[model samples]
Target: MASSRLYLSAKSAAALDAELMSSGGFSLDQLMELAGLSCAQAVYKSHPPESKRNVLIIAGPGNNGGDGLVAARHLKLFGYDPVVYYPKRPNKDIYNRLFTQLSNLKVSFTDDVNKAITETDQILDAIFGFSFQPPIRDPFVQVIRLLESTEKPVISVDIPSSWNVDSGPPKSGELGAAFMPDVLVSLTAPKPAAKFFKGRHFLGGRFVSKEIAKKWGFSLPDYPGVDQIVELPADNEKL
Candidate 1:
């Protein structure tokens, strides 16, 4: 059943990436782009752009942030007004290029989470990847705190900030004091948190080739036509 679908740990997910890319003939950029585009699709599918056109993208300093940057680009093109909150940016050129792309597209960046939340109808939480640890520090702590305090809907990318990959929520009061996503998008594979997500869930990483799926023993549901993403079955549904 979908409730009993497989989940990957941080270690296992990393290994799958190495195997998928090294042996399965895919590049990191390809996966990132696919994941980001899938996220944009989820944003539109979950909430109609006509009613919810304003989005606040909260990005971290890792690859997940890169995904947000890419997603913001597509969200803008998709007819949604996406503003970004990139507290800490990675020094990688690819990330800079993405930032540049946003600039070229005239997408604005905001540092104030509270203000951005007021302006946006929804949020994309890309502030952490699978490797994030609990007790989030500094600006991220402040940003996440604001997100939790507000009622704006959030769509967490990959893993929610400070959540443990294998153990679901980290060991803290009420799910690690993290921002609970209204919609959760799992890239590459669903982490253990998939079981905890009661909201709409999406499985991304369509870039995974057939060889990788067979070798890694992953059974993915049909994405349907040209859609970049598809809603995952609820726990009650059979896999």
Candidate 2:
């Protein structure tokens, strides 16, 4: 695996996505599919189906949520009983298609956020990505509060919800409950906020093109053998 010192800001990562598309090596659909698949793999590796098969995925209203929805489908195939709590569905047709896919896979959706946690052995925090801002609204806030209250571990996808793109979090330091997670699965590379993640950190999304990687000076470690995920060095060890 590559050394853990490399970090990419939100904007840069997005640019890499665009560049890859331009190169004709990847499309948004293909990228999302692989990204979500990688998340499922990480979840499986961290907590196998036999250990904690009940996964409660809290999907947001954007691409991050789509990733979660996709991950849910894969997790079910991987033998884990997966459920989703998607309170806000995007108006975009793409999300609608994803919703349909998950439904077709027989992955159930729950309306009661708090009750959902009680029914899960682990939580997948896919409510936000690198672009999410603070002052989270309504039912989501309540849901976050409930996750904090529970003792079960949460596996956050990409950047943790409500955190800034470049910085770890706000200086006011009020987002106590939702700021941390048990495991963080970063797609492509780690963002700045990932530096504060005090848990198992794994890097996914090894599908980046060499052309884009060179342009951005992004050095990626080869995926060890055929594995899709690689564990990152801890925060302190990053130096």
After superposition on all C-alphas, the RMSD of every candidate to the true structure, in Å, is 2.0, 2.4
Worst ten in a row by lDDT for model 2:
170-179
The C-alpha lDDT values of all candidates are 0.81, 0.81
User: How far out, in Å, is residue 22 in model 1?
Assistant: 1.4
Candidate 2 Cα lDDT to native: 0.81
Best-fitting candidate, scored by TM-score:
1
lDDT of 2 at 123: 93
Model 2 regions lying over 4 Å from their true place: 1-5, 176-178, 235-239
- Residue-level lDDT for 41 in candidate 1: 88
Name every residue pair that clashes in candidate 1: none
Q: Among all windows of ten consecutive residues in candidate 1, which has the lowest summed lDDT? A: 170-179
